[model samples]
Target: MDLTTLTYIVVGFTFALYIGIAIWARAGTTGEYYVAGKGVNPVANGMATAADWMSAASFISMAGLIAFMGYDASVYLLGWTGGYVLLAMLLAPYLRKFGKFTVPEFIGDRFYSKTARVIAVVCLIVASLTYVIGQMKGIGVAFSRFLETDYTTGLFIGMAIVFFYAVLGGMKGITYTQIAQYVVLIFAYTVPAIFISLQLTGNPLPQLGLGSTLEAGGGGYLLQTLDRILVDLGFTQYTTMEEGNGFNMMMLTMSLMIGTAGLPHVIVRFFTVPRVRDARKSAGWALVFIAILYTTAPAVGAMSYFNLINTVKPGEVGAEASNLLYEERPDWFKNWEQTGLLAWEDKNGDGRIQYYNDGNEQFAQTATEQYGWQGNELTVDRDIMVMANPEIANLPNWVIALVVAGGLAAALSTAAGLLMAISSAVSHDLIKGIFNPGISEKGELLSARLAMAGAVLFAGYLGLNPPGFAAQVVALAFGLAASSLFPVLMLGIFNKRMNSAGAMTGMLVGLTSTLVYIFTYKGWLFIPGTNMLPNTAEYWFLGIQPESFGALGALLNVTAAYLVSKVTAPPPEHIQHLVEDVRVPRSAKEAPAH
Candidate 1:
C-alpha cells in the first residue's frame, strides 16, 4: 500500500484499539476515575507513566532538536530524565505512601491548612495547563502535517478523541491506553532509529552507531566529519562545545532539570501505583524507557548532520549545485515538501539547499561569497526530524504508518493524563473536600467528567492559537514547576518543621519571581515585542536567558520557604507523624475507605 493509505490504516486501527480499551475499563466510581482504584501493577503503571511523559516532543521533536542544535540540546536529555531520579529517590515513594488520590490532596492534609492546599492547587493548575498546551499543539501539528488538515481542525479532532477515552474511563481507561501507547510509540521511535543507524553506520543500534565511523565519508569519525562540514558551511562542530556564554548554558541546563522535577502532570502519575516501594520502582522503570530514546538521539543527530551536508555538496549526484532542478529532489525532500515543512530558495542562484548551523565565524565570509547566499532559506522545523525520518531513509510504507500512530499516541496519552490531573483536582480537592463535604462518589465522578470536558476545550483553544512552538512553551511550564511546586513538596516531605505558613509563602514567592522573570523576557505570557529584556546579552542577567532561569527560581523557592518557616512556629506533632508515616511504607494501613 502507499503511504497515505497505510497511514489511515495504522492510525485508524490504533484508534479502534484505544477506544476498545476505554470501553473495557470504563470508570464506575470516583476512585476509579481519580486513581484507577490504585490497583495497577507496578510494571504496567511504569509503562503507562512512560507513555504519559514522552509526548510528541519525545517521539517527534527531540531527535530533530538534537540533530540541528548539536551540543546545545544536551540540556533536554539530562534535564528530562534526571528529574525521574529525583522523583524516584525523593518524591514518588513518599507521596504514594501518603495514599492520596491526587497531589493537592496530599499537600492539604499534610499541612492541615486548606489555604496551603489551595496554593498548591494553584501551582498544579499553572504547571499542568502550561504543559498541556504544548501537548495539544503537538497533536495539531502532527495531524495537520500527516492527515492533511488545518491546525485548528486537527486540534478539535484530537480533543474529541481524548474526550472519548478520558471522559469515559478517567485514569483507569487512560492507564491501559497509555500502556498500549507506550508499545506503539517506542516501536515507532526505535524503528526509524534502527533503520537510520544501519544505513549510516552499518550498525542496527542507534546508540552505539552514533559513536561508530561515518559511512558517508568512506571511514572517519562521524562526529568529526559533521564538525568539519558544519565549520565549512558557517556552522559549529556537531560534537564539540558550544560558544554561547558558559554561564548561560550552565544556568539553562540547571533550570530544565528543576522544571522537570516540578512538573505536575509527571508527578501525578506516581500517585497511581499501589505501594511506596512500587512507586519508586515504577519511577526507575519509567526512566529506563525514556533512556532508550535519550541515548539514541545524539547519534541520530550526528548521522543526520552528515547526511544533510552530503546532500548539499557539489558534484555528488552528477548535477551542478547551482543548476539543480526541483523535479530531481530526493524522496525525503519531496515528502517533507508536501507537508510544507521543508522549503528551498535559490538565493545564490545555486539550486542546492544549504542548512548550516549559522554559527561558524571563520566560514561566514566564504558562505556569503561562494554561495551568493544572503542567509539560509531551508525552513525545516525541528519537530519534523523524527516524524519524517522513516520517509527520509526510504523505509517501508508500514514503518511510515507506524510513525503516524506513534506521534498520535505520544500526544494523546499525555493529554489524557493531564486532563486526569485537572479533573481530579476539581472534583476531589475543590468540590468534595471543600464545596460539598457530603457529596457521594457518583456525584463526584460526574463533576470529574464535566471538568475534563471544560479543560479540553480550554486546551484546544490554546492549540488553535499556540503561543509559540510546542517545545518553547513547554520550557516555561518546566520553569514554573521548578520554582513553585517542587520546593513545597520537597520541604513538606523531608523537613519536619516546614509549616503551612512557610510552604504557602514559598510557593507564592517562587511562583511570582519565576513568572515575573519569564514575562519580563518572554513577554507577559510570551506575546512577542512586549518583553523587557533585549533578548540579547545587553539585558540578560549575567548572560543567562530567561528560558534557562528555572533552576534559580527553585533556589528562590527553597530559600523563601526556609526563611519564612524559621520565623513562625513549627508544624504540629501530628504533621510530623504524617511525615514519619510516609517514610515507612511497610507500617501503612490501606487507603482510607472512600
Candidate 2:
C-alpha cells in the first residue's frame, strides 16, 4: 500500500483501540471518574503516568528543539526529568496520603479556606489549558501532514477523539487507554531512532549511537561531525553552549523542574493508586519508562539534524554546486511544503535552496559577495523535524505511518490528562466543593464530562492560532505551573504553620507576576503581536525570557508567603496536627477524610 493508505490504517487502528478501551473502562461514579476508584496497580499506573506525562512536547517537540537549538535545549531534558524526581521524592507520596481526588481539594482543605481552593483551581485551569494547547498543535501538525487535511480541520478531528475517550472514560478509561498509548508511542519513537542510529553510526542503540563515530563520510565522532557541519554553515556548534546564555538556561531548567512537580494533571496521577506506598512504586516505574525516550532523544535530534543538512546541502557548504536543486528536492520536502511548515524561496535566482544562518552578518556578507547567495532561502519549522525524520531517512511506509500514530497518541494522551485536570477543577473543586456543596455525585460526574467537552473546544480554538511551536508553548505552561502552584503546594505540605492567608497570597503573587511577565513578551493571553515588548534578550528583564522567569516568580511567591504569614495568625492546631499526620506513613484506609 502507499504511504497515505498505510497512515490511515495505522492511525485508524490506534483510534479504534483507544475508543474501545474507553468503552470498556467507562467510569460509573465520581470516584472512578476522578481517580480511577483508587484501585490502580502500581506498575500499570506508572505506564499510564508515563503516557500522560510525556505529551506532544516530549515525543514530538523535544527532539525537534534539540535538533535546532542544540545545547540550549538541554535545559528541557534536565528540567523535566529532574522535576519528576522532585515530584516523586518530595510530593507524590505525601499528596497521595492526603487522599484527595484533585490538587485543589488538597489545597482548600489543607489551608482551611475555600478561597485558597478557588485560587488553586484557577491556577490549575490556566496551566492545564496552556499545556493542552501544545498538544492540540501537535495533533494538528500530525493530522495535517498524514491525513492531508488543513490544520484547523485536523485539530477538530483530534478534539473529537479526545472528547470521546476523555468524557466517557474519565480517569478510569484514560488510564487504561494511556497504557496502550504508552506502548504505541514508545515503540513508534524507538523503532525510528534505532533504524536511524544503525544507518548513521552502525549501532542499534540510539543512546550509544550519539557518541559513536560516523560510519560514513569523514568518520569523525558524531557530535564532532555535527558540530563541524553546523559551524561551517554559520550556526553555533551543536555541542557548545553560547556565552551569556548560562543564566537563562539555568533559570529555564529550574522552571521546568518545579513546574513538573506543580502540574495538577501529573500530580493527580498519584491519587489513582490504592496506597501511598504504591504511589512511590509507581513513581519509580514511571521514571524508568520516561527515561527510555529521554535518553534516546539526543541521538534522534543529532542524527536527524545531520540528515537534514546532508539532504539540503549535498556536497559542501558555500560551494556553488553543493546546494540541492529546488526542483530536485526530495519527496519529503515537497510533502512538508504542502503543509506550509516547510517553504523555500529562490533568492538571487539561483534555483537552489541555501539554508545557512542569515542572521550571521559576517557569514551572510561572505555568502552574498562570494557565493552569490542572496539570503537564507528555506524556512523549516522545528516541530517538523521529528515527524519528518522517518521520511527523511527513507524509512518504510509502515514506519512513517507508525510515527503518525505515535505523535497523535502522545498528543492525545496528555490532552486527555490535562482536560481531566481542568474538568475536575471546575466540576469537583469549583462546583461541588465551593459553589454547591450539596450537589449530588451523579450531577458532579455529569458536570465533569460537560466541563471536559467545553475545555476541548476552547483548547482546539487556541490550537488554531498557537503563540509558539509545540515545545515553546509547553515551556510557558510549565512556567505558569511552577510559579503559581508549586510553592503553595510545597508550603501546604511541608510547613505546619502555613495558613490560608499565606497560601492564597503566595498563589496570587506568583501567578500574577509570572503571567504579567509572560504576557508582556508572549502577548496578553498569547494573542500574537499583542506583546508590549519584543521577545528578545535585549528587551528581557535581567535577560530572563518569559519561559525562564518562573523560577524567579516562584521565589517571589515563597518570599511573599513567608512575610505575609509572619504577621498573620498561624493555622488552627488541628490543621497543624493534620500536616504532621500527612508526613507520617499510613495505609489508605487509615488516612483521615478531607
Candidate 3:
C-alpha cells in the first residue's frame, strides 16, 4: 500500500484498539476512573507509564535535536530517563502507599492543611495544561503531514479520537490503551533505527552502531568520518560539544530531573499498580522500557547526521563543478523548503548548496578556501529529523507509515494522560475535595470527563497555533514542574515538620521565582518580544540560562521550606504517622481496605 493509505490503516487500527480498551474497562467508580481501581499488574502498569511519559518530544523531536546538537544532547537522554530513577526511588512507592487519588490528596493530608491541596491543585493544573498543549501540537503536526489534512482539522480529529477513549475509559481505559501505544511507538522507533544501523554499520543495534566504522569512509569510525565530512563542508566535529557553558548543562539536567519527578501524570501512574511493591517494581519496569528508545535515539542521530550530510553533499567535494541549485533539489528537500525548514541561499554567487558548521571558527577558513561558500545553507528544521529519516535512509513505505503512527501514539497517549491528570485535579482535588464535599462520585466522574473534554479543546486550539517546537515546549514544561511542584511533594513525603505555612510558602516562592525568571527573559509566559532584556550568555547568573535554571529554583524551594518550617509548628501526630506509613510498601495492605 502507499504511505498515506498505510498511515490511515495504522492510525485507524490503533484508534479502534484504544476505543475497544475503553469500552472493555468502563470506569464505574471514582476509584476506577482515577486510579484504575489499583489492581493493575506491575508490568502492564510499567508499559502504560512508559507510554504516558514518552511524549512527542521523545518519539519525534529528540533524535532531531540530537542530530544537530551532537554530544550536548546527551543531557536530554540522561536527564529524562535519570529523572525516572529519582521518581522510582524517592517518590513513586511512597505516593502509592499513601493511597491517594491525586497528588494534592497526599500533600493536603500529609501537611494537615487544605491550603496545601489548593496549592498543589494549581501547580498540577499549570504543569499538565502546558504539557497537554505541547502534546496536542505534536498530534496536529503529525496528522497534518500523514493524513494530508490542514493543521487545525488534524488537531480537531486527534482531539476527538483522544476524547473518545480518555473520557469513556478514564484511568482504567487509558491504561490498557497506553500499553498498546507503547508497543506501537517503541516498534516504530526501533525498526527504522535497526535498518539504518545495519545499513551504516555491520552492527544491528543502534547504540553500538553509533560508534561503529563507516562504510563510506573505508572502515573509519562513524564519528571520525562525520567530523571529517562536515568539517570539509564547514561543520564542526560531530562528537564534541561546542565550548559554551558546562555549568548550564548540569543545571539543565537537574531541572529536567526534578520536573519529571514533579509531574502529576507520571506520579499518578504509580497508583495504578495493585500494591506498593507493584508501584516500585512498575517504576523499575518503566525505566527499563524507556531506556530502550533512549539508548537507540543517539544512534539514530549519529546515523541521521551521516545520511543528512551525504544527502546534501551528494558527490565528492572536488568532483562537483557546482553545488545543487534551489530549483534542482529533490521533492523531499523542496517540501521542507516550503516550510522554511530547508533553505538554500546562493551566497558568494555559487549555484551550489553550502551546508556546514557556520558556527565553527576552524571550519570557517577551510570552507572559504575549499567550497567558496559563504555560510551553512541548510535551514532544515530540527523537528523534521525523525519525520524525514526514512526518506533520508530510503526505507520502505510501510516503515514510513509506522513512523506517523508512532508519532501519533506518542502524542495521543501523553495528551490523554495529561488531560486525565488535569481533569482529575479539577474534579477530585479542587471540585469534589474542596468546593463541594457533598458531590457524589458519579457527579465528579461526569465533571472530570467534562474537564477532560474542555482541556482537549483548549490544547487543540493551542496546537493549531503552536507556540514552538515540541522539544522547546517539553523543556518549558519540565522547568515549571521542577520549580513549582517537586519540592512540595518531597517535603510532604520525607519531612513531617513541614506545615501549611512552609508548604504554601515554598510553592509560591519556587513558582514565583521560576516564572518571573522565565518571563523576564522569555517574555510574559513565553509569548516572545516582551522580555526585560535580550537573554544573552553575558547577562545570565553564573552562566545559568533560563532553560537550565530549574535546579536553582528547586534549591530555592527546599531552602525556603526549611527556613519556614523551622519557624512554624510541626504537623499533627496523625500527619506524622501518614508520612511514616507512606514511606513503607509493606504497610500498604490496609490502604484501600473497605
> Which candidate number would show the highest lDDT if scored against the true structure?
2
lDDT tens digits, residue span 1-594, model 2: 999999999999999999999999999999999999999999999999999999999999999999998988899999999998999998999999889999999999999999999999999999999999999999999999999999999999999999999999999999999999999999999999999999999999999999999999978899998888888889999999987999999999999999999999999999999888888899999999999999999998999999999999967776778999999999999999999999998978979989899899999999888898889999989899899999999999999999999999999999999999999999999999989999998999999999999999999988888888899999999999999999999999899998999999999999999999999998977887899999999999999999899999999999999999999999999999999888874564655433
- How many residue pairs clash (N, CA or C atoms closer than 3 angstroms) in each of the candidate models, in the order given? 1, 0, 4
- Please give the TM-score that candidate 1 achieves against the real structure: 0.94
Please state every model's RMSD to the true fold in angstroms: 2.6, 1.4, 2.3
Q: Estimate each model's TM-score.
A: 0.94, 0.99, 0.95
Q: All models: lDDT?
A: 0.79, 0.94, 0.83
Off-target runs (Cα >4 Å) in candidate 2 are: 586-594
Provide the global lDDT of candidate 3 against the true structure. 0.83
Report clash pairs, candidate 2: none
Which 10-residue span in candidate 3 carries the lowest summed lDDT?
A: 585-594
Best model per TM-score: 2
Best-first order by TM-score: 2, 3, 1
Q: Could you tell me the C-alpha RMSD of candidate 3 in Å?
A: 2.3
